[model samples]
Target chain A: MCGIVGYLDKVGTEGGNVGSVLLGMLTALACRGPDSTGVAVFGQHRPDELIAQIKLGENGNGTEYARKIEETGKEFGGREFSQTSAYLRFVFTETNDLHAFITRVEATGDPVEVVSVGRRLEIVKQVGSPSRLEKTFGISAFQGKHGIGHTRLSTESVVDLSHSQPFWGHGYPDLAIVHNGHITNYHQLRRRYEQRGTRFYTENDSEVVAVFLVDKLQQGRGLHTAIESIVRELDGSFSCLVATDSALAFVKDAFSFKPLVFAETDDFVAVATEEVAIRNAIPGDFTVREAQAKEVRVWSR
Target chain B: MVEIDAAGRTTREVNRAIRQRIAESCKEVVLRNPGARHNLAVAILEDAHIRIAGSAGYYCGGLIDGPSIEVEGSAGWGLAESMLSGTVRVHGSAGSGAAAAVRGGTVVIHGDAAARLGVSMKGGIVIVAGNCGYMAGFMAQKGTLIVCGNAGEAFADSMYATVCYVGGEIANLGTDAVIAPIDAGEAQQLEKILSTHLPATLRSTKPAAADFKKVVAGRKLWNFDKREWRTWQEAL
Candidate 1:
């Protein structure tokens, strides 16, 4: 089992303390998962610029890897370079071929992975708990309109930076997903997607959700439609939360095998695998309710 | 009445304090600032009243032989599960598996209940004043489950001698679950149960007991018959 959390500022004009709220929620749910923690936050959006986070593997020289990534950025006219631990962030102009650009970045020496590429989304994940994430990245000080966080317990997949979730929707910018339960039909779905030439990145079953959403969006289906289709097509006992640049959505399987609760006030909306997350994170009065079986809720800025 | 503050204490400390107060002959114990912590007031064998001022986490009031536990806010999963005898009443909703496998008890939810309510019960009376989610009373054995609001899909699947009543619309019945007519005595008994557990204001807003539909096992699942192949296929 994993813990998934989503928060959105209903009063969208001001950027609330999205990061700190997410940290509080994730920390409360730390008991659910101890392997890894990650968050995908939506920051100030510039329509013409694209932001990307690249995970430089921990095995190599940090400065050397940063320099190589800077060189690659210069090749693509990327600017605003920043580094946090093993992660490198840069802004580049909108590219016509994102897949080729990501492919180019991943080929830079030893085991470079592109964690996320989006106009407003920036994903930071590592192989540790929420406290470790906070110490490493100071995640609580982050301010934004909305974000999604996850603490993962590796049931079938290996515990590593690459296998951790808040999985970016591979080529789909600004789309991220976190899931709580296993996808029973992962192997069959993987075979079908692979036959249709979809790349499988990690052996993690949850990764398929992001890819599936990307595929649906490519087919011109809206986000809500894609999520509804996921409830129908995906065979599993899962409760999933999906976040994009402008909206957040929650989806549960027919059986509702996983636990998910949400609290809504006039000011903000918060959802987690347990109500304790929201109660401990946010103060004041709010109505907390459980998301029923085969339920989907969406909030947009 | 004794008040135990749970603000800065661990779960073990709070439970210990509760048991300690009961040992000291405190009749009524009120837990303040519960903060949705799990396993509060679990396995208490004393015959006393415990009131949780705020929301509680998983397994609240579980494994208790005697005690009337009240929650002002909601409860998490496995609320009052495996109780030998007692009453667990939640002013707010309940999480999944409320009153699961209870040998004897009364579990009441003033608001909605999530999935798997009263699942695998040996004996008890489970009541939800509001709606309930899917697979509620699934595989339940020898108990009475009641839902005042709408029942979600696959209600009461694969039960053994467990009687169920739904006051609102049932989305769909589960495999081998058949609806039988509710007799006058059963309806009056349901009314008495509701009045005994619910407050007057809350009781007035709910549907009358006479409107409820009774659901029981068809007994086809009790023993496998080759002629009932289709029913057995779905049950499996």
Candidate 2:
């Protein structure tokens, strides 16, 4: 079973120290999953700037990929270029088309994949523990309004960055999700979405949740309405946390097969698969309650 | 009386310290800063009083006997599971599968309990001061489960000789779980049990034992018959 953790600052106290809080919570849940760690942090919103993160292929030459990315950035008017070992980050003016920019970046050859593109959302995932995530990306240094994370235990998917969770809604800006249980109807739903020309980035079952939810948002449904529909439509044992630019929400399946607990105070709200994570990472007293079957709650900034 | 601090200590270390204290004939052991840790106290066959100051994670007091354990905070899943004897009480709520497969014991929860409470209990008494989640007492063999508040869907499904009593509304009964009328004598026994375990303030807030609805298995699944198609259909 994988572990899911989410933290949202209600009072907006200087980025909420979200990075450090999420790191500690995920570390406490390391025993649940040892395959990989993934986090999606929603930072300060820029109305006219879009941030894009890309994962380079494992076998490609790093220098070659970097050179290609730099050349593409020049043509696309991208700025704030940052490169990690296997990932690249770029900020582009919002005047550019999101789909076109993603296409242009992936066209740089070397099997480039866009991890996420949004004004406030930045997703980073790698094959390692939560501590490894800190060493590699200094995740605790990230300051943001809200965030969600995942510790993955690969069930049917391969252990790789692409298969990792906290999946970004590819076309839906500022949308990310982390799931704990398997979607029983993944294949049927994937086929239906594929027929509509929806591009699926991963073979994992949980990827369908991001696509399904983004589809609802595109249909002009409110976040709460969309999550409620998840309880009805999705068939399986799942407890998922979905994050948008301004809100964080969790939805549990009707069967209550998967476990999810949340602790809330006036300052912030924290949720995890187990109370151990919340108690170990968060100080102070707050009553922890288990999310019942078909429960959907949203906390907004 | 002795005190053990779980701060910055491994589970094995904390348990070792507890066993050491017990060996030294400490009458009472207080563990602080439990931090919702898993398997805090397990396989303790000694007679002593153990107290957890804060929350505990999965399997807090499992496979134990002859010790009265108390958790001042909420407990995670599988609390007091498979305990042959002893009493495990939590002042706060409990996660799923509380007291699962216990052979003998009394597990009491003062707050609401998550799903699957007292599942497959061979022998024991589980009392919840508040509501319980879905499918509680599923496949239980022999025991008593008392819910002072509402019971969620499919209560006591496919059980064997396990008796249930709910003081509040039941969302739905499970397959082969039939309601039986409670006699005055049994109601008095329930009242005594509730009074012995729950505090005065808590007992005042919940429904009295006289109003509890008794539930038991119809035992049709124990020996199947082709003519009982409706029961067989739902049981499958």
- Candidate closest to the true structure, highest TM-score: 1
lDDT measured at residue A63 in model 1 versus the true structure, 0 to 100: 63
Docking outcome class, model 1 = medium
The count of backbone overlaps in candidate 1 is 0
Candidate that scores best on DockQ: 1
User: Tens digits of per-residue lDDT for model 2 on A1-301?
Assistant: 9999999988875456899989999999998999999999988787788888888775334657767877787676788888886888888787546788777788887468888888889999988899999998999999987899999999998888889989999877889999999999999999999999998888999999999999999999999999999988999999999999889999998778999999889988999999999987789877787877787999988
TM-score for each model? 0.97, 0.96
Candidate 2 chain A, run of 10 with poorest lDDT: A57-66
The Cα error of candidate 1 at residue A258, in Å, is: 1.2
List each candidate's DockQ score. Answer: 0.74, 0.65
What share of the reference contacts survives in each candidate? Answer: 0.55, 0.45
Tell me the lDDT of candidate 2. Answer: 0.90
